[model samples]
Target: MVNWNSLRDELEQAKQEGRYRPLTVWESRSGTWMTLNGRRLLQMSSNNYLGLTDHPDLKEAAIRAIEQYGVGSGSVRTITGTLDIHDRLEQELAQFKGTEAALVFQSGFTTNQGVLSSILGPDDVVISDELNHASIIDGIRLTKAHRKIFAHKDMDQLEAVLKESAGFKKRVVVTDGVFSMDGDIAPLPNIVELAEKYDAFVYVDDAHASGVLGKNGKGSTDHFGLHGRVHIQVGTLSKAVGAVGGYVACGQVLKDYLIHKARPFLFSTSQTPAVAATCLAAIQVLKQSDELIKKLWANASYFRSKVQELGFDTGGSETPIVPVIVGDPAKTMRFSDLLLEEGIFAQGIVYPTVAMDKGRVRFIVTAGHTQEDLDFALNALERAGKQLGLLG
Candidate 1:
């Protein structure tokens, strides 16, 4: 057998650098709450923004799908794998997004992989946001395109890159609608204007925004009110929608291209019927119910105000995702441990995920958390911060 000692050395190096995340196994999860090692705790770490993971409607849909269609699709979408549920989900997604067509992939990761690899070649240029998601970075790298990264949320730098790369066969400007780490909205209007000026294609990964920001939780495009300006809108059922899989909403031409050329969509097994069926139900809930969204924003606003009033830096956050910035990685991890002890379950995010010396304890709020829950979590946070010398 080939020696794998070098891989162990790299893993050790990652651990030493405070970048290796040994994820804590969760025993179970409820609405904005979870159990770990048999301890029930308030969950501020999950991305289930609407608390839809175990939603009654969503659960029932999944249960029915499991009973009717069985567990897995068991084949790639190209090979008798596109089930009726998958087709319905795609059609419904296209309608919901106000786009001509849509294509579902195994996940948001594979969505990027499909689109990037299909549309880009050696002569093309992909101008990406510096702080875009890791999946986007990997997808761009996989393509033969020349990847150019602009400063995080910097329109001037983006335009500069587009201008400098004068004669590429094609150009694509990619960005995250809501940056997952920092929780700030991207300047899509400016990006759209630049794309028009340079004849560049536009792509936005709205993973974090899909069920949190837009009208009836439509997403960042809806938040910014730039409906037709974006060439492609990539989103996930995993994050805010509280399900599995991902999709890209774009024009018929783009969808057609992806269907014929994207390797991930061609090779990967389609989403399970239960997952697709549940996701469709979740979207219906999003479209019809504003009550949950209102509560979600209300809770987020309250938490932000309380946390800020208590004197912790939240790092430019304007949404439910709040980060208590901790300069050192060890201290950030300690902060998380302390929060867990206090019965709050927020997690620490460290480098190389964020910049060096900018580790943070990131807390995600949802409609599921009530006023009393927020207050309880806030109280625990204050105690932990004071004990860690984060708040004076």
Candidate 2:
């Protein structure tokens, strides 16, 4: 018999500990503002960096694609599901990243898992940054490779791991180009130099960096001018691209290898026609204009500065995703709840997502946010902070 009481007790325990994440149903399109539970709130926790999620061009492209190719791809890419739009999206992504070839997966998570698990084996080793995304962690777990994690972005520690991995048949170094929670960028140039010195391959998950860094938002590779230097690049279209799925940009040989060996690619259905077409359109938008990217950074800079000026501790953030550390889970939850009540929607980050004493309220600033919108949000935050005694 199933022990349902144990499950219920676990749920109660989680809620008491402030570890339970309840779903918020949005009644409107998730844009700069979110409509939830009959009220409109200024959205500050979304990943829609460039505000393209509700862009008319993307919506129209998706509609056109649906009318032409129907809703779903009907099968996996290796079978009869590869559409013209899929090939076009891959080509566009490769060109965007200046890579020899690119391959699309079901999502950013699956992309990391597939790439790592397929290429690595028992005799290989994976050296990762300690704060890399959970998807990367799971990807490493899937492989039989010996895993070595260095303190977050510690070049000295990374080199130590590389020195110890001399005997491994293959050494792969992986990192997130942008740390999502802290909004810090990985030192790709330094990582590349280390990889060259240690004869290891470099892989970076640029999910947060795409459309948010480099020249016209070309990502970390372009940001650091390390084109053709880094070996593997994985990114998500769901972020700034305002679409779905993820991609791997690499040399043609690796693409070919992934096509055959990556189980997620082999087993998963192809992306819907609408998703592919919409992503293609979004890429075109990215290439054609730097207006949105500039606005996004400007907004990020403004919001980060305002929050810091309010005496909030935004821990080492260099991007729009700023974390206001509250240090206590209950206080952080209270702050978030108060912000929600005041028509602002920023989620509280607690244990397991971060350390016990590092609970925070993470804010994501988007390009669509006008100065008025930002000021309004900041005012709400200030009032809430004072009321909750969070302001110093």
Per-residue lDDT tens digits for candidate 2, residues 1-392, read 87699899988887998778778788998798778888888999999999888988999999999999999999999998899999999999999999999999999999999999999999999999999999999999999999999999999999999999999999999999999989999999999999999899999999999999988778999999999899999999989988889999999999999999999999999999999999988988999999999999999999999999999899989998999999888788989999988889999998888888899999999999999999998999999999999875
Query: Which candidate comes out best when scored by TM-score?
Result: 2
Q: What does candidate 1's lDDT look like per residue over 246-316, in tens digits?
A: 99999999998998999999888888899999999998999887898899999999999999999999988
Every model: Cα RMSD to truth: 1.4, 0.9
Clashing pairs in 2: none
Worst 10 residues of 1 by lDDT: 14-23
Clashes of each: 0, 0
TM-score of each: 0.97, 0.98
Most lDDT-accurate candidate: 2
- Residue pair clashes in candidate 1: none
Q: Which stretches of candidate 2 lie over 4 Å from their true place?
A: none
